[model samples]
Target: MTPRSIDEITARADEFADMFEGYDPKPGDLDAPVPPVMAVKLAAWRRDVAERELADAVRAAREQRLSWREVGNAIGTSGEAARQRYGATA
Candidate 1:
């Protein structure tokens, strides 16, 4: 998937968050069909949450003076690639 801008991610993520936040369940909802659009939005929100979590983990590792190579190894990527993707100037 192409990378989304932070603004877009934040906006869309919040929309999904609100959707589930005030959700009121109805009887037979489990057996009812869900709108495909909502399903897609849920999937996107999940991805956004996981990515933010990964970013936080990476930031912690960097703060501890961990090498990009080590981070890459742990995350199944190359050292330089990891650094570039995470916006690590060093």
Candidate 2:
């Protein structure tokens, strides 16, 4: 897959922010109901974006000669764990 440009990522982030900004619940409406499927789909979309960004970052780090240990430390995982998770994609 082609890597996303910084501009593209920024635009997407802004779009996500806008989504939340538009969804502010009314004051004192503690029991406001949201569609269950909407929540599920939003969560899935966020996960998809996160995984794509992570794969891109891992590939870039490998290209820059960064060790898996360094990547692991940055991502709060063990070196072997990072390798096992991202090696094939990187």
Candidate 3:
């Protein structure tokens, strides 16, 4: 599959959410007609897009000389924790 943009992934996720709305009363839903392979493809696409976006954000944050405190706050972690996790890599 081709690389997908964040917007495309978000849009497809939204579509999947819509598809499951008020699904059914049965326990299995296994008889449902959705393509099982589509779920796998979407999950892989999401992981790729998320990683790219995270790398870009880390690069931008480092370029701005923003503190690990700020980044960690945004990520719900301690500054030291954030640095240990991503600083050198960033």
Best by lDDT: 2
lDDT of candidate 2 over 8-76, digit per residue (tens): 999999999999889877787877676999889989999999999998999899999999999999899
Report residue 25 deviation for candidate 3 (angstroms).
29
For each candidate in the order shown, give its overall lDDT on alpha carbons. Answer: 0.89, 0.93, 0.83
Residue 25, candidate 2: C-alpha displacement in angstroms? 14
Best of the candidates, TM-score: 2
The estimated TM-scores of all candidates read 0.60, 0.62, 0.50
List the pairs of residues colliding in candidate 3.
none
lDDT of 3 at 35: 77
Residue-wise C-alpha lDDT for candidate 3, range 13-83, written one tens digit per residue: 99999888956668766766657799789889999998778767866897899888988887788989878
Ranking by TM-score: 2, 1, 3
Q: Candidate 3: lDDT over CA atoms?
A: 0.83
Q: Candidate 2's C-alpha lDDT?
A: 0.93
Ten consecutive residues with minimal summed lDDT in candidate 3?
22-31
